[model samples]
Target: MKDVYGEAIFDFYKGDHSVVLTTHNTYGEPEEMPVEVFFRDHQDFTELENLAITSCEGKILDVGAGAGAHALFMQAFEMDVTALENSPGCIETLKHSGMEKMVNQDFYAYESKYDTLLFMMNGLGIAGKLASLPFFFSHCKKLLNSGGQIILDSSDISYLYEEGVAKPNHYFGEIQYQYEYKGKKGEWFDWLYVDSKSLVQETKELDLHTEILMTDEYDQYLARVTGF
Candidate 1:
């Protein structure tokens, strides 16, 4: 892997001035999106993101911490936060941006524990597929200290389909995505966007408790899961 996504982000962070993320998804036409790295400096955030960030406590791990935005925001409050990312280029960007703590490793492979596992911006997508939820929850369980919580956000995305249209046989939240930047393309990957109902059910199956913190008009929601 050449870290195509990371390279684009790095260029943007290094003052490229014209960088944008070209994203392709299974549900829609390709779109040119602003690099999230820029959002690090914005004071206004979505209600869901604000809820997740304000709810953080103790040692926090921001998984998939692209550009270290969420981690940086939490750190501003003097919270002990670590930005965990797999991209070397993004990690370098984090360091350059003055992120105090960082881990350049895949979330699943990292063994350390935390009081709060913060996953914003549909970070739960890392679960990849509905069937992988069990393993995902189990791994997160091992990574949490007693009384710790997983605060994350995701959207229903079922609205993407028309009323008369039939959805896929499997869960509708399972999505595929590919990245393109400066005429180069990246490999496609599965990304899950679980609805709150399914998420609560899965938490029950795993002996965890879940709460829907907030939901917006766009079908996006924030949730909190805690070990029993």
Candidate 2:
């Protein structure tokens, strides 16, 4: 897969004020994703994001830590935080941002224990699909310390489908997307946006306890998962 996303991140970080990253969905329409969104500071975070930030405890792992925005905030309070990112270009941006600890490895493949796994920006979408929730939960079990919490946010996305609209046979939240930057496109990938009910059901089966921390006006929610 081409690192179109990383290139965009690096470009934006390097002061490319006009850099625009676009994502394509099944609808064949390109959705503009402003690269600067990843660079937002704490003041610019949404209510749900603020909840996720305050929920962090002990050693923290900022999963999919693009641009190191959240990690930079945590550092202000002398909080132990690590920025985990797989994008090489983003890694350069993180280094340039003066992050104390940054790891360049796939989330599931990285072995480490942390009290809080902060997944902002719908980072839970890394699960790819609904059927893979168990695998995602299982990996969280390995990465969390005893009584650790997984603080993340996700949207319902069910509203995208109408009452009588024809939907795919699979879960509606399992959306496919491709990133394009400067005319170069990356490979398509599956991203999940699980609803609250489905997320609770999956956690229940694994004996994990989930608590809804907050829900924004757009139906996006912040959740805390523990009892691992």
Say which candidate scores most in TM-score. Answer: 2
Give candidate 2 misplaced runs (Cα > 4 Å): 163-165
Q: Write the per-residue lDDT of candidate 1 for residues 1-228, one digit (tens) a residue.
A: 768789888998888868877889877789887785444564767777888888888999999988887788778778999999998988988999889999999888999989999988889999999999999988898889988999999999887777654687788999898899888888999999999999999889888999999999999999989972
User: RMSD in angstroms, all models?
Assistant: 1.6, 1.3
- Output the lDDT of residue 196, model 1: 93
Least accurate stretch of 10 residues (summed lDDT) in model 1?
36-45
Q: Which pairs clash in model 1?
A: none
**For model 2, what is the C-alpha lDDT against the true structure?**
0.90
Report lDDT (Cα) of residue 2, candidate 2.
84
The segments of candidate 1 whose C-alpha lies over 4 angstroms from its true place after superposition are 36-38, 163-166
TM-score against truth, every candidate: 0.94, 0.97
In order, candidate lDDTs are: 0.87, 0.90
Write candidate 2's Cα lDDT for 36-154 as tens digits.
Answer: 89999888987777778888999999999999888998988889999999999989999998998999999989999999999989999999999998899899888999989999899
